[model samples]
Target: MLRRARIGLALGGGAARGWAHIGVLQTLTEAGLAPDIVAGTSIGAVAGGCYVAGKLPELEEFALSLTKRRVFGFLDFNFNGSGLITGKRLCGELDDHLRPVQIENLERKFVAVATEYGTGHEIWLSKGRLVSAMHASYALPGIFSPVNINGRWLMDGALVNPIPVSVCRALGAQVVIAVNLNRDIFGRGTIVPDHEATDEGPQGLEDLARARSSR
Candidate 1:
C-alpha cells in the first residue's frame, strides 16, 4: 500500500496585499499542487476559506469588481465602538459566498487563526461555521470591530501568528508551505532623516528617573 504525505498550505495576513493570494492559489491549481490542509491568519483566512470551499473563482470575481467607490460601499461607519466601520456589508458578502457550510463538512482540513482581544493569545478555529471563523480572523481592531465568539473578543490573527506554520504542524501536516505577504513592502520607500531623529531626551539620571516613573 502506498500512502501520500499530507501537505499543508499556510497563508499570511496583509490587508489589501492579501489579494495576491488568489493568484497564488490559482497558480498552485495549475501546477497540480493540492494541499490536504490549509491554515491562515487574518486576511489569509478569507482567501483560504474561499479556496477550501471551492469558491475561489467567485471570490476572485468579487475582488476584480472592486473600485474606490465600490470599496468604500462596504464600509458602514459607526462611531460607538473601537472600529469606525460596522463591517456588516462585508460580512454579508462573505456569507453569500461561503455560508451554509460547516468546517467539519469540508473535503479538506481548514484552520483560521484569531487573536484573543485582552489575553493576546492565539485562537485557532478549526470547526463550526466557516464564514464566522473567516470574519473573526480578519476583523482588524481599529478598522473593523472585533468579533465576539463564545463571550471572548477576537481581533486579527496578525496580532499573533500572521503565518500559521506551527498550526499546520499541529494539525498533522507532513509538509507545510507558508506564504507571507508582508515582505518587501518597504523596499521602494526612501528613508529621509527628520529633525526628530536627532533628538535624545532625558540624558541626566534625574530626568531619566522622571521619564521612567511617568510610565
Candidate 2:
C-alpha cells in the first residue's frame, strides 16, 4: 500500500481579513486539495475551528449577516481586562455555533494558537473545550479581552506566530499550505514608514482594517 502525503493548512491571523479563509477553504475543496491537519491563529482560529466542527456554512451565514449596527451590538464593553470588549457576547455567539464540539474528538487534527500574556509564549491548543480554545486564540489585546486557562492569561497568537507554519509541521504534515492574510500589510510597498508612525496604535481590529483598506 502507498502512503498519501498529508496536507496541512496554516491559516493566518488578520481579524476581518480572516473571513477570506472561508473562500480559501472552499477553493481548496473544489480543487481536491483539502487539508488533513489545520492550524490557525486569531480570527483564523475561529474559521478553522468552525470548519473542523463541520459548521463552516453556518459560520459563513453568521458572518454574512453582520452589519455595522449588528457588529456594534455585539460589543459588551468593560475595563476589567486588557481590552475594551469583554468578549462575552462574541463568545456567546460563537458558542451557539460550536456548542458541543471538543478538540479531542475531531476527525482531523486541529490546532489553535494563543499567546501567554506575560511571557509571550505560544500556546498550542489541541485538546479540551474547543470554543474556549477558539476564544483564547481570537482574543486580541486592547480589542478583545484575554482568556484565562490554568492560571495563565492568553491573548492573540499573532504576537508570536501569526501564520503558524511551524505548528503545521509539528503536527506531522507532509506538506503545508499557509494562507497569510497579513501579506499586503506586511509585504514590501505596503506598510507605512517610521516617519508616519503614531504612538497610539489601532485600538481595534476595525481601525487596523480601515487603515489597510485606505492604503
Candidate 3:
C-alpha cells in the first residue's frame, strides 16, 4: 500500500521522499493525508512542529539534519556505555507495528513513535530496566524511559518538549509508541530458525534457537 501510494504520488508530480524518522510525517502531508491534530515522539516532534507551523518546505532538510544529530548523539553515548546505540532497528520495528495499531486502537491509546537523540535510548531505558526488559522480551522495541517532569524527551529542534496538538479533539493522548535503540551487537552469534547458519544477525535456524531459548 505504501509503495502504491508512493508510486501514485510520483506519477502525479508529487514529491515522494523516504525518511527514517520524520519522513513519515512528510509523506503523510505530501500525500495530502494530514491529520487534524499532530503529535510527534522524540525527533518526530520536529516534523510535527513543521507541519503545524506551515513549514512543510523546510521539513525534509530539517528532519535530515535532526536525525544526523540524533545518530551522532547515539554514537557519542554508546562509547561511554555498553557500546550499543542508534534506535533505527528498534524504532523501525515499532513504527511498523504502531502504524496499524494507531488506526485500530486510536481511541484507547495515544500512540507516539520516538527515536534516539543526544542522550540515546540506552541511557533513557537504563532508568527502567524492567520496562525495557519487558519490551525486549516481547520483541516490541522501545526505550522505556519516562519523560522528565514535563513528560518529554530532550532532542534537537529545541530543548523543551512540546505538547502534541491533536488533529482530532475526540482522541485524547493515552499511549506512546516509544522506539528504543540500545543493545549489544550480538552479530552473527545470534541465531534464526528454519535456515542454514550464515554470517547474519540472528537469521535462519539460529533465530529460532534464540527465540526458543528465550522462552
What's the TM for model 2? 0.83
C-alpha TM-score for every candidate: 0.83, 0.83, 0.27
The per-residue C-alpha lDDT of model 2 at residue 6 equals: 91
Return the lDDT, model 2, position 126.
Answer: 80
Model 2 CA deviation exceeding 4 Å by range: 184-215
* Candidate 3 worst ten-residue window by lDDT: 6-15
Residue 174 displacement (Å), model 2: 1.0
| Candidate 2 local lDDT, 1-215, one digit each (tens) | 99889999999999888889999988887898878999888999899988988888988998899999999999999887579998989889988877778787888888888887887767777876778888888889999888876555778878888887778887789999999887632211122111110122322433544776898
Candidates' lDDT values, in order? 0.79, 0.78, 0.28
Residue 51 local lDDT, model 2:
90
Task: Put the candidates in TM-score order, highest first.
Answer: 2, 1, 3
Candidate 1 lDDT (Cα, 0 to 1)? 0.79
* Backbone atom clashes (below 3 Å) for every candidate: 0, 0, 17
Over 4 Å off, model 1: 184-215
lDDT tens readout by residue for model 1, 32-150: 99999998888899999999999999989999999999998998997987798877799899888776878778899888888768877677777677887888889999998887765
